[model samples]
Target: MNCPKCRAGKLQGITLKTKQGAALGLDQCSICGGVWFDRGELEGYLSGAVEVLDSPSLHPKLAVELDHCEASCPRCAKPLAKSKAPQSPRIQGDACAACGGLWLDAGETGGIALAEKVNAAFDSWLAGLKPKA
Candidate 1:
């Protein structure tokens, strides 16, 4: 499969196991180091059930700005809907409504994990604050 974002690299399948021991196979782009999640695969990462493998070279390219790029789903061949990753407005990803698939650019999966951690910590801190009398 070809990468939905770069459109140049072929996607290679990698097996990932969730915390609950459920195995999932996802596609990773060789050139851009992006990842493609099918259906609910991203949910596992959001819920802290999956561990993302380290891709040190996954960095945003200064030349390829995706803020306004219209990407197509590699699976369905349909135009993907652009949206910000949860808790990280700076990191944008494309979702395929037809297939419920998600495309995360280079370094985005790690960014999402970090953002969720920060948000959770902030929420906990806020909840612990006492009401001002």
Candidate 2:
């Protein structure tokens, strides 16, 4: 199993909790900003059924869903396919249609859970800007 992000070593298997507080295997990369997911893991993350660990980078309060498209399954090496969640479209995620594996980057894990905030921030920033008549 190659590290999906760095493409160096096999992913070190580490179970991580999703936003919803369920346990899931989320490979840790430590070196680069990346993690690996097996099949159906994305759905769990998106649903807030799983949560990333609590760390300076990982937000414990916020259920973070991982997002990364340019990653391949440690086993199959097929380019991970991405799809938008029906609920949160602003976020992009990758999955292996063949195997159902998933991959998410560092910040991506937090974006989906807080998507509304992202939109709100954008809207607020736009409101502050002068509009051209």
Candidate 3:
């Protein structure tokens, strides 16, 4: 499948290894650093549980110029609608209504990861304040 953001970059299958030793198959754009996540895949990736093995850390470029052309779903050819990244309202991404696939532009995935960490830390801190049962 081709990248939804950068039409020129072909989507390549990348296997992400989780801390638990499980492998998750994901697609990434070699040129633009965007990632395509199918239904349910984004949750696992944003959980801080997934990591790439023997791969260079993803340094998403923040200055990439997005193609103004409407992004579409590579899987189903449906027009992708803009939506906020899960659990991260500040980060926006594209979602396919028909297929439930998501297209996150360069640097947005990193933002989501950071948001997840912040949310986790806040939850932990909040939990500590609860009255003893």
Candidate 4:
């Protein structure tokens, strides 16, 4: 499969195991380090159940600037919609509305992981907050 974000990169198949022992198949780009997750894969990964290997740390100076580039789903050949990662406006990626597939740019997988951690922490803090009359 070819990467949707970087057309030059060929996607390689990989199996990711969740904390629940569920094995999920995903495609990743070799050249750009991007990833493609089929329906529910991203959600499953973000559910805090998957034990993903530590992705390379993010460096502000090395960040890749993404443009409003048009892309299609490698699975279905349908147009992909651009969307932001929940709770992290700065992290944006493409999604296939038809197949529910997601395309995360290089370093975005880790960014999403970080965002999920931050969101979880905020939720926990909010839960501990006392309501005043």
Tens-digit lDDT track for model 3 on 1-133?
8878768889889888777778788888877778888998877776545663232234344234563458889999999988876655676788898988888876667776676778889999999999999
Lowest lDDT block of 10, candidate 2: 60-69
Query: Which candidate achieves the best TM-score against the true structure?
Result: 3
**Alpha-carbon lDDT of model 2:** 0.59
Clashes of 4: 0
- Per-candidate TM-scores read 0.74, 0.56, 0.77, 0.73
**All models: lDDT?**
0.74, 0.59, 0.75, 0.72
User: What's the candidate order when arranged by decreasing lDDT?
Assistant: 3, 1, 4, 2
Candidate 1 residue-wise lDDT, 7-92, digit = tens: 78899988877778877777888777778888767666565456765553633553256434678999989999887655336667
Root-mean-square deviation (CA) per prediction: 3.6, 8.9, 3.6, 3.8
Flag clash pairs in model 1. Answer: none
Clashing pairs in 3: none
**Residue 120 alpha-carbon offset, candidate 2, angstroms:** 12
What ordering of candidates by TM-score runs from best to worst? Answer: 3, 1, 4, 2
Across 32-80, the per-residue lDDT of candidate 2 in tens digits comes to: 4455656655566555544443322545332242332266766687777
Score residue 39 of candidate 4 by CA lDDT.
78
Off by over 4 Å in 1: 56-63, 66-68, 85-91, 123-133
Q: Over all chains combined, what TM-score does candidate 2 have?
A: 0.56
Better of 2 and 4 by lDDT: 4
- Evaluated at residue 85, the lDDT of candidate 4 is 51
